[model samples]
Target: MKKFIKKIVLFLSPCFLILCLIVVADPFKVWFNYDDYNSAVTQNGEHVRFKLFNNNKDKYHFDSFIFGSSRSHAYKTQEWKKHLKDSASPFLFCASSEGIYGILNKLKYLDNLNNPIKNVLLVLDEHCMRGNSNKKGHLYISTPALSNESSLEFYKTFVVASLNV
Candidate 1:
């Protein structure tokens, strides 16, 4: 029995060490607060944008938003503000590869926050309009906060992904 236990420990030790490294290193920036993320690793821009908005929403008090995939980046906030009331504080709520579900969830999240959504500009392409489900992969998954997904599962997905490479 003691020999069997030793073998079990030996087998698990590497996995335990890898998990520890995942927690400490946090290559995906999921476990720590960061000023900026590594650009080389494609991150979930949706999660990053949501974190930024959630953290600074009170300070900025954004009332207007531009929502879409990377294409939305073309619409400058300053330029969009020109069309809205002077009191409008516009924010860009874009994702790397946004889908319709992502856009709806973001809107729902803001509504839940009781945020005054004064104006919205939605830039959509064929793909954005067609997609009806949350994307998979670490770089495309919607943020758990907005998607109402289990936080554990979200982190686990990243941890598993990190292990793959």
Candidate 2:
């Protein structure tokens, strides 16, 4: 009986650890947060397209969006504001390895907003369509919601990925 219990504990250890990481890391920006995700862990926060949006979407009012891979990062919000001469701000949703999925998701998300999307600049490269599967895209900048998956499924996929790592 003791040996069986020991084996059970061993099997559960990794599961517990992964759960802790998910809660503490809070990549989805929905778990373990109180008043606000008002905070985040920087260890893996660099891939923050989702986090940045989640943490500040309600606060920032943007009429323009610059979407693409790393190339889009060069367009500062100020530059866009200056060029367009608009009162509404611009938000750049760029990452090192963004693809069609991420771009489409952000666009859809912006489209559903109450305010109108004034301008959109999408910069693409040969590698944008290099892959057929959305799951294979960059993990840091992707979200399940963009792919039409439910939030619960996203959490499940995240947990599974945690185990793989």
| Per-residue lDDT over 1-165 for candidate 2, one digit per residue giving the tens place of the 0 to 100 score | 999999999999998887998768665454433344333432222135555665566787667778887777777878778888557667777755667766777777767766568888787888767523454312443455555665575566556555554
Compared with the true structure, what per-residue lDDT tens digits does model 1 show for residues 5-98? 9999999999999999999988777777676765666677887788778777899899999999988989999999999999999999998789
lDDT of 1: 0.87
The C-alpha TM-scores of every prediction are: 0.87, 0.67
**What local lDDT score does residue 164 receive in model 2, on the 0 to 100 scale?**
56
For lDDT, the strongest prediction is 1
* Model 2 misplacement above 4 A: 1-11, 25-47, 137-141, 150-165
- What's the distance in Å from true for residue 145, model 1? 1.4
Q: Clashes per prediction?
A: 0, 0
